[model samples]
Target: MAFVQLLVTSLLILVTKADVAIDIENASSDVYWIGILANPGLPIPSNGGFVLNGGQTTTVSVPDNWVGRFWARTGCDSGTNTCQTGDCRNGVECAGNGGAPPVTLVEITIKGDGGQDFYDISLVDGFNVKASIQPIDGTGDCSTAECESDVNAACPEQLKDGDYACYSSCAKFNTDQYCCRNELNFHSLMIIISPRVPLKFQMITVV
Candidate 1:
């Protein structure tokens, strides 16, 4: 997946050292199974996954230094515990496993250098849904990272995964250039969004 390197600076204000509060909501009409993947040795919230019905919201707490990613799995079967998109292949709880490609991701790192938190929305895997992240009651430059557009509507015919999700060129073709494998700088991988569509949000690196 594409990675965005965020730069965070020290703040003069006294930052309270506590677990970070993450509020997740399902803004769409479809039922969503929220998946969590934490860094190795870190705790995975909600045992790695949970279900969120339409318009439902839930909160999860993570340590100040937690590092992880979150995504939503759609078209899941309750009996089989599988999903048409973003399935981890191990049932509802990913148990630290990441979602399948062609899924939207919200990546985060809490309390890094100088007590700054870093976050971004990545489509390097591809776009399955419109997703966003907003900081609530935080200090310093806490900007929202989001992609509000319906990318699936403009997804190229070749990149479409049925009618449910869109695949990144790299995921579909596995070419070095599309995957940024040729680049020596590992931090700035280039993701190619279809030029035929107008993206509503630029991939953001926020502190």
Candidate 2:
């Protein structure tokens, strides 16, 4: 079976107006990977992108209002900035560019939706590795969000055979149910959607 290492994270966020720190921990036994961050309407993150060897930790700092998504590039050559899985610019920094589609993404929008921070593990782009986030300092019933299973193993026919990720069925099928979000078709669509992993979003309420 063809296997690929995808970027997946479960973070426990403690939201505040102060600068935020992100610590990336690599759990792989032998893969050399780098983390890529792409910010929208903000400057490139200081850590922007950095290499992490097996069992290494790299930390980055971002402003409170920063909104962006992060993903990992596996089997990458820091010297070349080329990744077998999530390559960005021809260098370490992402230069504010998003990763190629079908890549697993961990996205966050701080101070969104009634002044709450929003975070999610999205499979809409695709499914690769597992991901989740926990609030480190905060209060509320904000559930831990995650997607750890590899959906590619059972990827729908049209969306299968991707590099190592599985595309959203709606993205590939584009039917009335998947694309239009028709309530009438929801019941019938559930069966088709049931097998696929569900994306998760968490809203953190700061104390």
TM-scores for every candidate against the unseen true structure: 0.81, 0.72
Tens digits of lDDT, candidate 2, 26-117:
66664534444645457566446666667675666677776777776665675666766556655666665656555667776666667777
Alpha carbon lDDT at 31, candidate 2:
52
- lDDT scores for all predictions? 0.70, 0.56
Candidate 1 deviant stretches above 4 angstroms: 1-17, 183-196, 200-207
Off by over 4 Å in 2: 1-17, 30-32, 78-80, 170-207
Over 1-207, each residue of candidate 1 has an lDDT whose tens digit, in order, gives 011222111000112235655666666567888888988899998999998877666777777788788888889999999998899988888887788988888778776667677777788778887766656556677776667677888888999999999987777898765665556325345444557665733323321
Give per-candidate clash totals: 0, 8
- Model 2 vs. true fold: TM: 0.72
- Top candidate (TM-score): 1
Cα RMSD of predicted structure 2: 7.2
Deviation from native of the Cα of residue 1 in model 1, angstroms: 25
